[model samples]
Target: MEHSKIISAAMKINQLTDLNTYVIDNSGEFVFYHEDISIPAFMPGSGQEDVLNLYNQMMIQQMNQLYSYTNEWGLHYLGYSFSTNDSFAVIIGPFMYLTPDMYGLSREYNLRNNESEDLRSMCNQIQVLKTDKANSFASILQQFELLINKEAVPIRIVANKDNEKYRKRENNSIMNDDADIVTMRYKLEGNIMHAVEQGDKTTAIKLLNSNDMLFSFSERFPNQPLRRVKNLAIVLSTLLRNAVIRSDVPAIFVHRVSEKYAYEIEYSNQLSKLQQLYEGMVEEYTDLVIANTLTHYSKVTQKVIEYLISFYDKQIDKNELAELCFTHPSHLSRKFKQETNMTITGYQQMIRMNQAKHLLKNENISIEEIAWLVGYEDASYFTRVFKKETGYTPSQYRENN
Candidate 1:
């Protein structure tokens, strides 16, 4: 195969997967590099020198095979060695098999005061993949090797021996048996909450599903399976609620969701329903964080936004909102516009339209009822507003959607 063809294939793979790809000569120099996402410079042993050294190590092994490397920081990579007139290898990654442990990295790397923040920011930039997804990534590298080298090679995961040792060391560091379980459980819960707060529903749900044993209440309840499952569901609901609250989602929204789940958790008779509810809770709370979190808004603006969301079906008076936010009406309007890029009435209208659409989906509610329900007294006026906002009349939206 021509070297240019190999480079072109690697570039195509990089573009397709958004993973960094490199073609390095046998001399351990990069002949071509395609970086879609920037890898963090501060990550230990993730630099050019480290990459070249790892390639040399693979060369010394003298095997034209695909290899995986996971450094101490939990960053993963794939390498495939091949020859096209000259010896060369294609490298991909700096992806992750697990979320990076910021505290562990800070302790192990002896990061200076300012470097800890840099490490955290960098850790956020890396793609975290589950085991199956990581395996799929390995298969991508295999396909890339077949494209360039014209032969198939088995994926041999190397560089994870140290990872095993690190895990053993961590496991051995735990002092007491009961405390160890408690600590491990808290760590997993913390990870779930952090993922939820970031609106990472995939990571949060993945962590939750993968760590079911830690969350099992069966052992404690013995024969009472339904009671155990319901208790577990309630605990998970509380955790998700707190996570979204920490993300600065309005208390009203969080409370409504929490209450809805609370009712379902208690009323659910089957364990399967409870199991499904756990994922639902994570998904809804994460979506709340994504859609309703007001962390970036000023306090007054946050209050106004919350008010709009909670009372979109009722008539809104700017003076009342101004008084509620402890500011004059004009200042509140300006601040709200500056922060949200929408006037108070405009924001309220958006909320009304969203609610109107949701109600329209039910098909049981008439347009006039929905109009009254969403704060418009005149049904025709509500139809005009709904049509203007959605490019469909309420009845048309119900029929189409």
Candidate 2:
């Protein structure tokens, strides 16, 4: 078969499977690469040099064979070689056979110097497949090979015995030390709290999902799985609440979001639902810090900002806001402008515009409805304001985004 036809077929398979696919020519140069799922930048084999080195090694070994290789970090890949007047190989990979242990992966990849949160964030992005699914994908690739090259390829699993030996040795050493486990748990918790306080949602959620030693409840509870998970959720909510408080978000805002998740965690029965709630709790709390943290403002300005945030959809009365802050309207206005570099009405509009953008991105409502939702009675006026603020009209923004 022609190389172009083979590349075209591989692209189709990539679309169908949503996996990263690559085609290397006989000289170990990349003829084509399609990435439906990307490998994280921090991983060991994600670099071009490392990939080409591996490809060169594979090309020298054999042809007309399907190969499965699992790296020391537990990331898996599939490769197949065949001749088409010359040799070519199809590579699919960076998936996992099982959920990876972050600690073990860190040791294997010499990634301990990297932030644990970042490592976990990268780890969480990898896809995990069951044995059957892995086999099924392999079979599809094999069939593609047979169709394109007109030769059947035998599947080969390359065993990394050295990696296995190292993993067992490291696991035994780490598992036997109780102090290391305790230290890891505390360090993980502190890192997650730090991520939350900084409003780093990506890092927070990744840290929450990363550390198996800290987050695994089965070993702690053995039997009462639901109770164990709920307990962990409750603890996480309290931790996030404190972190938000430290970020200078109002106690009322933190309480409302924390209380909501606390109730949801207790009543939720499904593990999957609870897992989602865990991420949601991190997101909402981190957003609270992003939206409401007022550490830099005066107490009066802080109160006014909080009021505007809570009532952005309603009409603002300057006199009423001044009364609430125990000040005259002119003084209140001047103070707000001094602190925030925008007039009170301007700040309110900014909040409304932000809310409108959020709705535009996440909600499936009409433009007019969105205008009403963001406190604009006139859809045309809202469109003009949105266009001025974002350079793109709402419809265009939605389409472009």
Q: Top lDDT: which candidate number?
A: 1
What is the Cα-based TM-score of model 2?
A: 0.47
lDDT of 1 by residue, 1-401 (tens): 56677777788778766777888887767778976555456665645544665587678765566776756555667787766567887888878655555655665676654576667666666676666877776777667756665766555655424456346544544355467567668878877887687566776887887667778845678989999999889989999999899878889999999999999998999989988998889999988996766778988987887677656666778898899989999999999999989998999998788668766874364788678666777999999998999999999999997
* Candidate 2 lDDT by residue in tens digits, 101-159: 65555545555333444666655666667668887877777676655556675656453
- Per-residue error for 370 in candidate 2, Å, reads 48
Regions of candidate 2 where Cα sits further than 4 Å from its true position: 36-46, 101-118, 146-401
Lowest lDDT block of 10, candidate 2:
157-166
Cα displacement (angstroms), candidate 1, residue 70, comes to 2.7
Instruction: For model 1, give the 10-residue run with minimal summed lDDT.
Output: 165-174
Report clashes for each candidate as comma-separated counts.
Answer: 0, 0
50 in model 2: Cα distance from truth in Å? 5.0
Distance (Å) between predicted and true CA of 101, model 2?
A: 4.1
lDDT for model 2: 0.74
